[model samples]
Target: MKKMIILFSALLVLSASGNQTKAEQKADVSNISSANINQTIEILSTSNADKSLVEKGVKHAANLWRASDGTEEEFTAFCKENFITDQAEKELVFEKISRNIEIITGHFNKITLDLLEPVHLNTFEQHPIDNAFGAYSVDSHWMNDFYQNKIAFIIALNFPAFSLGEKEANAKNWTRQEWAYARLGDYFTARVPAELLQEVGKMAANTDVYIMDYNIYVGHLTDAKGNRFFPEDKVLLSHWNLRDELKANYANKNDGLEKQKMIYQVMQRIISQEIPEKVINKGDVEWDPYTNMVYQNGKTIDATPEPNERYQQILNNFHANKAMDAYYTDQNTFIKRQYDGAKEISAEATEKIFTDFMRSEETVKVGKLIQKRLGRKLQPFDIWYDGFKARSGMDESKLDAQTRELYPNAAALEANLPNLLVKLGYDEERAQWLGDHIAVDPARGSGHAWGGAAKGQKAHLRTRIGAKGMDYKGYNIAVHEFGHNVEQTISLYDVDNFVMNGVPNTAFTEALAFIFQKRDMLLLGITDDSPQKDALKKLDLFWSAYEIMGVSVLDIRMWKWLYANPEADAAQLRDATMQIAKEVWNEFYAPVYGVKDQTILAIYSHMLNSPLYLSNYAFGNVIEFQLEEQLKGKSFPAEVDRIFKQGRLTPNQWMVEATGNDLSAQPLLKAAKEALEELK
Candidate 1:
């Protein structure tokens, strides 16, 4: 599932202007000193309340107060006035805040979904006004409004914010209500300007539009010798469809290698901004990605390369995020916020996990096994080798024909949702309930699952469905997104706390999606009974983990470079990104592929739009492996319900509860090694 846009409810709430330095951005009036907090606690402590409760409430409120909020005296006054000392009253306050936030956030999410329909769904012809409305964030001023009403300060006063470190160390003892309170405390930690928040949302929407429309007329692509390989009517969106197309070609018997090489070249052109500007989303031109040449109506013409537009998108996101850094006193950089706040995993820990797996000897073995299976030396693009997949050996055309016939349109797939779930071991009633909660739609771009924020609101499963039918590739992606819908429904409707409505992060959802994706064939009534199936599954997962971990490292390094060179322009960023990709590839992938300095790692579209999200795929794979182990001899529906309903725990804690192990590559690595030995 694609990560949803950062909700306006989650925007920064600090008082600093965008231009202020980090030091200058510190809370002026709200910065309550330890002495002041102690004095306030003493003053507030009376026969009605315990000193500890007063201290917790005062300290928490003081920590959350901002200069723009009011004077120090006002902060004290607000805390004393709003703090709920009586146990029954405090419980009531917590319930009110939780219920109110759910209503507010849920409505805002629904509004955004409805407004973006033109852009996100293919229900109608999109207009300029649609894009404008899609980009407009309804919740942009929500934080500001809450602060103005003093509601933010009240919540902050009652529910103290917990650091990630504190959560990790202490949350094992926390009740569901306590966890909800901590999440409430998380609401007002930053004080970014509303306009800046709006700008960021607009920038993301613009980027989404760009990525969605970036389709390549695969049929129109020509070779240096003026030969076209793909079907005349076929179109592939970058880099999702393009990458999947390359994977699909593993079953092609004629010129498959050439097609893969051509696709790799096209990816390189995209990454380096060397692709002809006219070739993108346009079939009027036929181009050779290798020779950097274009032709129209059987005549060659000079064409300008895309003018670093790809890098500019990245730079725009960087600047928008950077502008708010001063307001995030605790997690200042976007990198910090993404890991510590959004991912709830430290950067150091995530990096260590990714690097450890990528550098493992098991990865080397897997690469060698893949090369042996291919009966050729490894190319950088072999990172996507699909030979291990059972579907790779089947004719893609036959599968496409089958899928197209079964799902002739979006409605066909939507109608079959319950059947799909039932095939995966869900009972008839449960499957119907899940299906009812998830609405399927034709996507304008590659498909994604947009989860609903409130109960009774349907989570949308969007996938590309052609006029003729949903093809095999689209079907595969749809099933994956369907998994997200399942998890979304369970996590939201069944969870004990409203604040904890999703998984720990996108990765956990991705893991469930993978589980669903791997069963697409079963859903289609196609079964693979090969004895080597289990081993192949392990090897495939291992290889995928290896490939994405390298890309994740490159993504991390690219962002780090951007932070270091804040003044760098698009062209400069492009150079740095390519260099970072190569460096990461050489260090990790080169030893296995025996190919050095490949820029293929930089070709993921998520790096440009999602920002540091590639790591989640690698993490998801590791978690999926652990979950797969736990699911052995277990009920699929029961396990899924039990696990997903554990909602929004820290990743490691969730892992331990679900799998009786921490998130680690070791399980996957060990399984892959054993699989390789069996295959040998």
Candidate 2:
């Protein structure tokens, strides 16, 4: 996941209104007063130039210039000295700034990659120096330096920053260069201290490390009857691997439901800080999650529960983020920065979309269908029921065997990228090019795709590959991450402007990942020609969306609670999180699942480490479904290249260009209703 602090500066100050809190009402940090703005504009308008353009340039420069930058005289002189009157001259300056920023940022990205190697990669055990290096942001000082050198002032003078509302309203008329200029304005809008950014990075890195190494020896888990359901030496990482393991058991005939129940219990213990500290990442003892007891050599032993370490990490992340909130005068809270700034969509809008979809009749319809398939009452853990997938009935062991043989290591998977792409409709040459641009690595945690910031630098795809080999679960995650690499490679190397080198937000890239994940079976040469396959796919998407939307709601509510209760301790935060999860579950999920007060929705690791990222998965499903509809009759690879090449337009604009429709849950919901009828 991208560091939240890196994108924290991309905010425009919102106007104060009645609904805002007192703290939020004070968000504006513009250095220029209304009188000063008028003075600067009048002085610049006297020059023989377009009065409108001169006024805009002067006001923009005034907004960014502080007393520390200069006195009012210097601000006026700076605007008069730097504002470009000629259109051709302005375009030339824009190009120069874009090219130079690309060069600077590219090198900075490379430097960070090298410095973070020991921390991110599994090359060696992390040392104290590694932690410090990983926390250090090479580009943290760039903003301060640019402002001090007057480069930032020059850009602000020429390319005025646009509010999120302004961009949404007028983006249709903007040229690509205009969009690039708007992005440039976003670069220095916030003046957070470099030291604060470094601290945020360090806190995030520490949390990442803590989560990455959090493993549970499933084989050491025993039930009340003293029977181990998992294989010997089977280790699963918290929450991702554990959850995936629970889903995988739907195909197991012997003790599938029981295994899932046990995993669910383990998740509860972890979320509540009831899991024993010594048993974590250690295979030396057996434990029963239900009784919260440990055993060695068939004898019960005492162990202390983990002392709120999980919640402490989350608190540390919050404090680090909270420290920088004051610097963001407009988008004061991290929620505002995430939504209005990074997501380019309002939190209220996102929450409405998620809740509307979850509460729709289509969700209820699909839940009934899942219940019918399972031939039993739904449990709280049924949120993860894997019955909708094509492989739900197949033997997971056989699939795992096939994957293990095909991908004996990360190198083997890397070598097969070309063939996988070819199967998805890329030509031999194009497939080779994409494969060349992506590097696969053995991940120490759940897999993630890290896109290259510069041309020619390979995007890293990191997934777990055990000593034995890559299993089906790892292979599946690798394919999903590969989609991110493809989008990253295309947007960076093929896009026309360096400023527009990525999608509008992480959600757009996540849409591509979901698309590739849906085609994992296709990549493995497994095809379904059944007429009901399309309907099943729609149902799968709908059901998965239903599940994650609740989790997203929990994430959103938890963050809001944290902000409201900033002085709350770890234990208090944990209690609040569980209560919020239960509230969300009761309101939107209980009716469908026939269960209430479920805390399963609160167990996502991203809640603790990444913060407010769960919404992207839900949004991604909506986009992926729309893109899938658009690609129905087109060449897969060709359509992918065409759509991703449009570059970082706003989410709505990007969706319109890619699918000829706006991003909406209605399309998926409509299809889901039709699928439910057809299936019935």
Candidate 3:
């Protein structure tokens, strides 16, 4: 997941007018008419300096100026007083605002991080009060307060927001400072109320807590005969750990297929919300996922199925985001805000990218290769096929043992960060410096990296650590999160402009994480001397991309389904989501996997919590492949440092600068084709 601060930033801003009462509508409308805008523009034009920028700024300010802000005359006067036309003075003002905003937002981020500690980290026992604290958004009122004091008006007047098209079209020739100006201009695009922002924040926090706390006691899972299939103490979180465990079982010759099948059944129950309520996060009860039966003390008992809580949570999110529709006249729907506003990539373009990749012949070809390797017909769960990875053939238990012994806890991993970076080609001093800026925490959920909001604050790397130690899966995920920390630290501390810190989007960060994750074996000092290593890596990237692209497209379709049926209750939403999942599967995946109507695509927990985020993983795979191609013969550390420091350009511009080409799936597809031929 991206930083919570960054995610909430998406929910805070929306432009124009929508469904409201007459009085409310009047308040939302800009009292500044065209006459006021023209007058302000004319007054500012006397300087003959930054002529186009000044005009754009004035119009933008007028559009956002509300009746609550000031009268038309006062609006015009404020713009005339605040508009900075002198080049040097404007730059200086930008710098000061940039520095101060960083301080304000950074401290706000720290407050949230501190408040959510009990909920997000394993530092202490969770309590109801902690949830309240976690959900209490301190910065929710910041924008509203700014608007009341006309600070937002000043910024909007001086630095107007740019459309994605405008930034992309002109970014190639722009300097770093110009890019920073564009980003600063993006600060205040709309004026959502503090109440609406607070409501969304509470919904998001609650949903996240639900997801993180959802644990499935796999050890208690039984077959039809009440036979246990996993270790007695084994437990896995829904979706992430379960999926990883399924992937890990490929090396278990004794019962790998059966385990995968069992996990697949468990996932089906979760998506359909047919799993017993007592079994969730409860180790005291035993359940047969295949039969959907619950047992206590070896006696069968009537158990209630989860009462559509999963669906209700997502519906709650929909309603929370939907309430903001009246405020966002330009991008009315939450879907539009998520894609175009937050991800800065249009939903249509993102969907096209995934669908195009899915339709490629290489996808089916790779499925056939996996079937050949497995010596069985492909199952729906084969989407997680792990044979292409370098470590696939190695014993997973041995890897787990090694990882546990190598790093027994979060502190161990924290101390070893510099060593891992040094192995990846960083010098000792630089590695130590980078490590010092990153903090490690035991995550309550699977794992995620939280980037620092300011220069001095540390980026947090969080992963699950057990009583024994960090397992191979946790270590692998931690390494990925560490990659995010590396990028986060570098981008924040190394970028030329404060406002330009961080990558263009979460996909760019995920790209770096994937890049680091692929080198897990090397980081463990395990060398792959296989001549086919390069080809295998290509196939792995291709297959992973193919799998997630389908899920991402499914996510998009589910949201589209919800929009079409906005009055949908939880049960109705469940049925429609299942139908949409089947439709997507049958269209894109059935031929490849030789299966029809699989709801596994709906199994991602992200669909319920992080709306419209699955596409980033798909895009990350593409960007990672492109960057890997770029890094083939270059200095690893130097290239990564230089590329990440480019910071927050549009997707294509960032790709072109980093890899000498635009972001596309073609490179991965082309490589996978060659890999299949070579392996054959």
- Runs in model 3 deviating more than 4 A are 7-27
| Count of backbone clashes, every candidate in sequence | 7, 1, 0
For candidate 2, give the lDDT of residue 363: 71
Q: Write the residue-wise lDDT of candidate 2 on 202-244 in tens digits.
A: 7767787888889999998999989999997999998889988
Candidates 1 and 2 compared by lDDT, better number: 1
* Cα RMSDs, all models: 2.3, 3.5, 2.2
True lDDT of residue 623, candidate 1: 88
Decide which is better by TM-score, 1 or 3.
3
Candidate 1 residue-wise lDDT at 294: 91
What is the per-residue lDDT of model 3 for residues 77-99, given as tens digits with 9 covering 90 to 100?
88778888788998889889888
Worst 10 residues of 1 by lDDT: 12-21
Q: How should the candidates be ordered by lDDT, best one leading?
A: 3, 1, 2
Q: Sort the predicted structures by TM-score, highest score first.
A: 3, 1, 2
Tens-place lDDT per residue, model 1, 450-481, is 88887778889999999889999999999999
Q: Model 2: which ten-residue window has the lowest total lDDT?
A: 11-20
